[model samples]
Target: MTTQQTFARRVFLVAGIYGIAALLPQYFMEAQVGRDFPPPISHPEYFYGFIGVALAWQLAFLLIAGDVRRYRLFMLPAVVEKLTWGLATLALYAQGRLAVFVVGFGLIDLTLAAFFLYAFHSTRAERG
Candidate 1:
C-alpha cells in the first residue's frame, strides 16, 4: 500500500479499535466508576452524557475512517473532541481535580489528536 493508504488505514484501525475496545470496559465498569471516582456523584446526567457523547464521537471516527476524503470535514470536529477531553483531563489533573487515570486518558486523547492532525494535513497534501 502507498503511504497515504497506510496512514488512512492506520487512522481507521486505530479509531475503530479504540472506539470498540474502550467502551466495553467502561460498560462493564459503569457502576464501579461512580464508586471509585474521586468526586462525589452529584448527578448521573453528566456521567451518562459524557459516555453518550464519547460513543457518538467514536462512531464518527469510525465513519471518518471509512472514507477519509468524504469525512474530512468531520476531522475538524474530531480534533475539537479530542482536545476537549485531552485539555480538560490535563487541566483537571494539574489542579488535583482528577486522578492519574484521567490524566492517562487525557494523554492518550492528545496522542490520538496528534495522529488525527497528521492524517488531516497529509490527506489534504496527498490529494491536493
Candidate 2:
C-alpha cells in the first residue's frame, strides 16, 4: 500500500484501540462498584470529554491521510490543533490535575504530534 494509506491505517488502529480503552474504566467501575473497583475520586466528565476529542482527532486524521491530495489543506489545521492540545496537556500536567485519563489524552496528543511531523516531512519531500 501507499505510505499515506499505511499511515492512515496505523492512525485508525491506534485511535480505535484508545477509544475502546477509554471506556474500560467506566465499565469496570460499573461491574465492580464499591467491591473490587472503586469509583474514581474525581468525576469522569473531563475524561469522557478528552476521549471524545481523541476519537474525533484520530478519525479526522484517518480520513485526511486517506485523501491527502484532496485534503492537503487539512494538514495545517490538524497540526495546529495537535500542538495546541499538546501544550494544553503539558499545562494540565504541570498543574497536577492530570490523572490517568488526562495522561492518556496527552499520550494521544503526543502521538498525533509525531505522526504529523512525519507526514509533514513526507509531504515536503514529495513536493521537492
Candidate 3:
C-alpha cells in the first residue's frame, strides 16, 4: 500500500478501536457514568441515543478501513463527529460543568479529528 493508504488504515484502526473502547464501557457501567456526571443523567433518550450514534460511527470507521478510497467522502462527517463531541466536552469543562477526567475523552476526539482531516485530504476519488 502507498504511504497515504497506510496512514488511512492506521487512522481507521485508531478511530474504530477508540470508538469501541469508548462505547462498550458505557453499556456495562451506565450507572457509574451517571454518578460521575456532575449533574446526574435523568433522560435515557439522550444517553442511549449518543451510544447508538457513536456505535454507528464506529461502524463507519470500520467501513472506511475496508475501502478507504471509495468511502473517503465519509471522512468529512467523521471529522465533524469527532470535533463536535470533543469541542462540546471541552466547552462543558471550561464552564465547570464537566470534570477534567471526562474532558480526556474529548481530547482523544480532538486527536482523532486531526487524523481524520489528514486522511480526508489524502484520499482521492477514482479517476475513471
What TM-score would every model get versus the actual structure?
0.87, 0.56, 0.92
Candidate scoring better on TM-score of 1 and 3: 3
Clashing pairs in 3: none
Sort the candidates on TM-score, descending order. Answer: 3, 1, 2
lDDT per model vs. reference: 0.78, 0.62, 0.85
Residue 82 miss distance in model 1 (angstroms): 0.6
lDDT of 2 at 111: 77
Q: How are the candidates ranked when ordered by lDDT, highest leading?
A: 3, 1, 2
Superior by lDDT: candidate 1 or candidate 2: 1
Instruction: Encode model 3's per-residue lDDT on 1-128: one tens digit a residue.
Output: 77887799788977898799879778666687767763566887888888989999999999998888878888899999999999999899999888899799899999999999988877663312
Clashes of each: 0, 0, 0
Q: Which candidate is the best by TM-score?
A: 3
Tens digit per residue, CA lDDT, model 2, 1-128: 56864664466456445555654565435334434435543656665676567667666766775666555556667777677877787888889765556666767766776776666556554441
Q: Model 1, stretches more than 4 Å misplaced?
A: none
lDDT of 2: 0.62
State how far residue 57 of model 3 sits from its true place (Å).
0.2
RMSD (Cα, Å) for all candidates, in order, is 1.9, 4.9, 1.6
